[model samples]
Target: MSVLIKTVGFSLGLTLVFTGVANMLPQVEGDAPVDVKVDLSALTMDDFVAMGEDLFNNKGTCTLCHKPAPLGRAPDVQGTNMVAITTERLADERYQGKATDAASYILESMLEPSAYVVAGWGKKGSDDAESPMPAVDKPPIQLSDIEVDAIIAYLQAKDGNEVTVALPSPDAAAEVAKSDAAPGGAGAAPAPAASGEEGLAKYTCTACHALDSDDTLVGPGLGSVGARLSEGEIRQSIIDPNAVIAEGFPAAMPGDFAEKMTVRELEMIVKLLAEKKQ
Candidate 1:
């Protein structure tokens, strides 16, 4: 009888231990830590307004494109100066059509700059005709944690006193960097070089153009380009686009100065393209 009792006790103890272990396991699926997933039911409007100011001016450098009207270098808040502009934009029928609130719209703008361009903002003939805003999510200028939170706070405050969706803090920025460096992350593997003649295969020139040499895609291609243009000509063609515009190619190819691209990278790419045989 004592042995039976001991066995039962041991089984109960093991079950409790397993239960404890299960409880200790980390949450595997859901929004990322940096991802703004928490409910902002407790925050206040004053908090967000302060945050927005920081983001607009120095934090995320949002003013660079929006060209604040008063400032001219940043986006101008037309309603009640900068403080009230957030709410005004939130109420504006145009932006609100798709976004749930001012805060969400602001956050989305930072995350996906290409999704919706403010009307009449983009270059006359460019793909982003609706908005000319440069993508802020790209490299070399990642936003800090405090900056994201400040921007989020500013937008939430504009909506007549509501819960401010506080973004993760600066400490979170380090985590973002680590995640990006991890395998398969955005900064993971360098792209493979693709031969232009093989047809645009997604990663290579295809990103900016179509496959056929003559067929117009985002940029012109190699049908007779190899035979006609010398290596120097091709290299010059890219570095100094205004130097020559192919018969049908648009003159708008953005030039990459030595300031933007290394000499080695430019030379290698130019050489590879120049060597392509018809």
Candidate 2:
């Protein structure tokens, strides 16, 4: 019995050491959360355009598919003059949309992506008729109306064209910011996801990574991810995706989840994914 007690004590000590070491690691991934609150006082064209640029690269997730060839699945917004392209698109017989000007074209193109599928940018096997781009005002990439307009303003300004899109009224913009704002700030933020399933739906992870079944989407199957990756690894993939690109997929996961997910919400989904061992 003395020998058994000694072994038990040693095992308990080892358990405490492992627990302490785990707690010593960083809690939040990357830096402190970037407060995306829009400055209501600074509603100038410059500010709005800057916000648009930020969204285009960050929240908007446009670069995922809009990269230059041969990787780009969408039209390269940077390489080609989008303003000029909009002009030609409006004139094209294939143009089924209602936007007659650049600002409208950009807005319409985002919300009504299928209205004008750029010649070769359509979804595969659709004969250039279907677009893979989701509406910016909709799920997973829910940019508010003001946010969408901000993108148009940015694009126009970036192309050296006049910013014809109207700046959002302070009151109107504030309402939008308020609804999505976290506790402290009145900046634009994603609608909250209260549960693990809600988070998966909000971010639409199942669109690419499967929750169950071998029938995965575009990205690799994540059905048995926990059996494969540790909880820490799953958390890292969500927060700092590019840190370790999953073997067969591009470094295409968004790098801004650290900002989007609340700590509890993040842990909820992480726990859910970590249990996906089947």
Candidate 3:
């Protein structure tokens, strides 16, 4: 009877030890979390506004298109009341978006940019009906929803207008990052374009320059640039943009394409932009 009691006590002790070990191990309830999965909810509006500024300049690449007027490929909000103009945009005969207010108009503009192309800023051949700007949620400049709202908030606050966008939540941030990261997310730039159209879209050239058409954009019409500048001159223009400002246009071409573009990308873009005269 004493042997039996000893054996039972030993078994119970082993079971307790195994239970303790299991408890000490890290407990993963489901799938592994993304490395960048972060709770953005705690970030204050002021912080997001500042973050928006940085993103607008860098990560979001908004400055690449939205510069001072008569210079930017897109409408330059500089010194312009984006909020006041938004109301006008909503009331325009051409306005087709579902937004009922300023904040939503800005957000919708970023998401479904084709919904209301600003006059004279549409893609070539779209008759001022289709914007050339890519949806900010897509590749090349995939600003997360929170980041987009931050930009709206910043823009609104910048113009002394009321910010109406809701703050981000932990789940929303985590989910967006996780989803966008799944398939070559915001961090990945597309490979060098294989064709002229691809190159044009990839580099956002059509935003400012008319490539195959006479449509007036922010930059000089490149439809016949080859009739003017040599191939080497075209290369120089891209790499050292500010060196030779085109007459009647602001020196607004981004000067950092030398750093941002790969050799293959540069070559393809140059090939497309510099068609030698026959």
Which candidate leads in lDDT? 2
- What do the candidate models score in CA lDDT, each in turn? 0.47, 0.71, 0.68
Which is better, 1 or 2, measured by TM-score?
2
Give lDDT tens digits, candidate 1, residues 1-278: 35434534543454455453223222121111122322234334454456456556543545433443533422453233333454565565565335556556666666665455555443335544344343345432355444565666665555454545654544555665565566434322322223333212211243233224544433565555667788868767765778787775445454433223323334455566766656
Ten contiguous residues with the weakest lDDT in model 1? 26-35
What 10-residue stretch in candidate 2 is worst by lDDT? 24-33
lDDT of 1: 0.47
The collision pairs in model 2 are 37-187, 38-187
Per-candidate TM vs. native?
0.39, 0.66, 0.62
RMSD of each: 18.8, 9.0, 18.1
Tell me the lDDT of model 1 at 81: 38
Sorting all predicted structures by lDDT, with the top scorer first, yields 2, 3, 1
Candidate 2 lDDT by residue in tens digits, 38-102:
75666799999999888888667777667787666567886776788888999999888899888
In candidate 3 the C-alpha lDDT for residue 223 amounts to: 75
